[model samples]
Target chain A: MLDNSMKLEFPSKSQNESFARVVVASFAAQLDPTIEELADVKTAVSEAVTNSIIHGYENSLGIVYIECEIKNNKLEIIIEDKGKGIENVNEAMEPLYTSKPELERSGMGFTVMETFMDHLEVYSEEGRGTKIKMVKEFKSVSIKE
Target chain B: MQLHFNVKDENLIVRFTGELDHHTAQEIRNKIDNKYKNDMLKNIILDLKGINFMDSSGIGLIMGRYKTTRANDGSLVLINVNSRMEKILTMSGILKIVKVYRNEDEALHNI
Candidate 1:
């Protein structure tokens, strides 16, 4: 359906992790992505939202904002949280480097997003908040040779 | 998520259904851990055939369970992991430490 955009704001509860992923996946379906592509988007969205709930907000009640846009065959998602921002974006993105290891976090959130999506960018301030911008290109909707 | 547990000897075989994510991981972990302690199970056999979706949180759950099993001198193995889930597990490098089986029998034999 051409290009479209949507925004969602929800409480930073663990339960909304699934909700965020499903909403993004449903919107991404307009791109006619394959099962695997859909799964990739869903996984990436889940990772971002989970990070907002557990790390950004520190598991306390907060707000998680998600913006999704489908442009041609490309889908861009921005997940932001007005919570405790990340101190080090690079270190946080490193695989297996979880600040909350006691919570059993695998620390693969950013890694998963980088692997599944075409582009990923992180913007954060020490005490402001964290924002994740990710873009994924769908091969299924690309022009054929 | 729903967990079906079967205890045989010192092994706890759990078949997980539904999505495994941050929302459901705690409940699933608690239930399995409780059963493992109450039944004194030494090993954990995770059957993931019924899992429709999973993310990195699934990896954390597995790794946590693996740690728990190891602490008790036991083991953890996975079975019926679809290619989709296998990709995530492989990306996380968990496959290097955990073993995967074709079915419950194979996991049972190996564990």
Candidate 2:
């Protein structure tokens, strides 16, 4: 059963990355997640939001949509951007492969998300946009007496 | 994020407080690089005791500094990494290239 959900839309700017991370972490707090779990979610959220700002919009102004839902012990996050999408996700996902090396990007955005989350799915069309959906299950759900 | 730097011998110790994300990585990189260039520091010791959060952008900042230090034949070390930041650094394979120390004294001694 879906107990709670929230959606947020903001400009694809670097500053908003922290905002996204805090919002997601605060929402996940209701699940009584451990500090490590919260940090994992926050890190994953920051990476997704940063990608949307840098790669999706190419630093230009665009909208980034973030939707989060909690079902039982699972937390699902969907980040979508309506901007220049990826050409080849496989190549993009490769570690240390960055289109904008000049920006000093490590090209580990997707890899970090994959490592910290239980499941990650990315969908993109070159001219359209990119959507990243990730899910993580909370392991420390507090039981009310 | 706030950054403070102290120069000891040829080593530059950078202490970071608050979050390290894309918003602050570029600024931090520029500041550190500028100091490195101006002072010709040979080693960099990153004090991570106050960093509560970090993302991939933080990794890029460290890697960039590592390259700069290597180019100058210097070294970079990390100290006081909390468990959370440790996990991120470990997963990113930064622990392999950059050495981690439990205290500033240890890092300075090795550098």
Candidate 3:
């Protein structure tokens, strides 16, 4: 019973990360989420989009697909990238483990997404692509002020 | 994002406005590093009052600055950290290394 849904395709560029966050946050705004909740969603979305750009595409040009759906108080977000896929997801998900450490990455992207979202699922095949599906259920809807 | 720098004694106070994320982290890092190199500042005080949003990249930025300050035998402190950002810092194990204060006055007094 989805109230509304959106799918966006943007270049795998660092600048587009902010654009992805804005789109997801704005779409989730209909849930009447609090400022903190909205920030959480924005941060999670930013991490996912950044991972796709930095890890998936590795600076090469590609397309990052983002799909967002809202059903009741629950929001589902899916970010996909068709580029170099993860060889070992478990290692990639480890804290402080980044393939591009020279880039000064903290390697906490997936951890932050997991912490902020209610549920997170990662699916990838080497040389294929990676798709991250995250869900967040708002505790209580706020009335328009 | 907008960054304001104020030097007091040997301390450098950086006030950040707007979101801090991967997109803006590199520019912010370069700016701070350049300022640190050219100025005689010993300590850094990051003012987070104007920052409404920050992701894990923010943590990396703080950590990198902390290392640079320590290398120069100086310290890095944080001020005006909202609860949301504080939570992220705490989770990332940054609070254990960096000191946090309520305002610039307190940070300046201590640093």
Candidate 4:
């Protein structure tokens, strides 16, 4: 039984986006993901974390929390932020429907997550927060020596 | 993130050697826009060979540049995009709008 999990809490700063991505990718590495699979997890994590820092927290400062778990050959990640939540998750997920066009947002965050991860779920409430849970399963898992 | 700029003919070729995401998009955009404005290049070519990772923010950056370049009556093209980045760009359906070339020379010749 190889089940491992970790938690992280950091400021919702734009710079932390890359930090979060790298951390989750490192955790998922335990499953022996391929280069492409690793890249996929990194991209998905980046998107979710960016969403929390940008759309969720907006201009205000808040905390971004991340929890990662490994079970079997699947990696599960949950990125949550207690900031301004999405009014409509469905509309937000629609590709190219950016609410911040002035900021040059392509509105592909949710789309990218769905594309890269095996499963994706988003939960949010106005004036509350947003939580994104994503999972990726490695098809070829090798036991470590 | 670092952006290396070079002017060839009427094109402004920018080589990006870092990850492209929301955090670095603004700085990179500002630099490219400044160069494009000052040099008055007729076309913009992005060399993505050095980019290791990207997200939707990269899409926004490219789209914004495409708009600015087109407004100048110019064109914007991409070169050396790896397979991983290609997958993200493909999902954005941006490949349909902006052309991608195998290399800078090919891009320069075609555009």
TM, every model: 0.97, 0.97, 0.96, 0.98
The TM-score ranking, best first, is: 4, 1, 2, 3
Chain B, candidate 3: TM?
A: 0.98
lDDT of 4 by residue, B1-111 (tens): 999999998899999888999999999999999999988788999999999889989999999999999998999999998888889999999999999999998998899
Score candidate 3 by TM-score against the native: 0.96
For model 2, the stretches where C-alpha displacement exceeds 4 angstroms are none
Cα lDDT, all candidates = 0.92, 0.91, 0.91, 0.92
In candidate 1, the second chain superimposes onto the true chain B with a TM-score of: 0.98
What is the full ranking by lDDT, best candidate first? Answer: 1, 4, 2, 3
Quote the true-contact fraction of every model.
Answer: 0.81, 0.83, 0.69, 0.89
Model 4 chain A worst lDDT window (10 residues): A136-145
- Give model 2's docking category: high
Better of 1 and 3 by DockQ: 1
i-RMSD values for every candidate model = 0.6, 0.8, 0.9, 0.5
Candidate order by DockQ, decreasing, is 4, 1, 2, 3
lDDT of 1 by residue, B11-78 (tens): 89999889999889989999999999988889999999999999999999999999999999999999
Overall local distance difference test of candidate 3 = 0.91
TM for candidate 2 is 0.97
The alpha-carbon lDDT assigned to residue A38 of candidate 2 equals 90
Candidate 3 per-residue lDDT, tens place, B27-50, comes to 999999899879977999999999
**Highest lDDT among the candidates is held by which one?**
1
Q: Write candidate 2's Cα lDDT for B27-80 as tens digits.
A: 999999999889988999999888888999988998998989999999988999
Off by over 4 Å in 4: A143-145
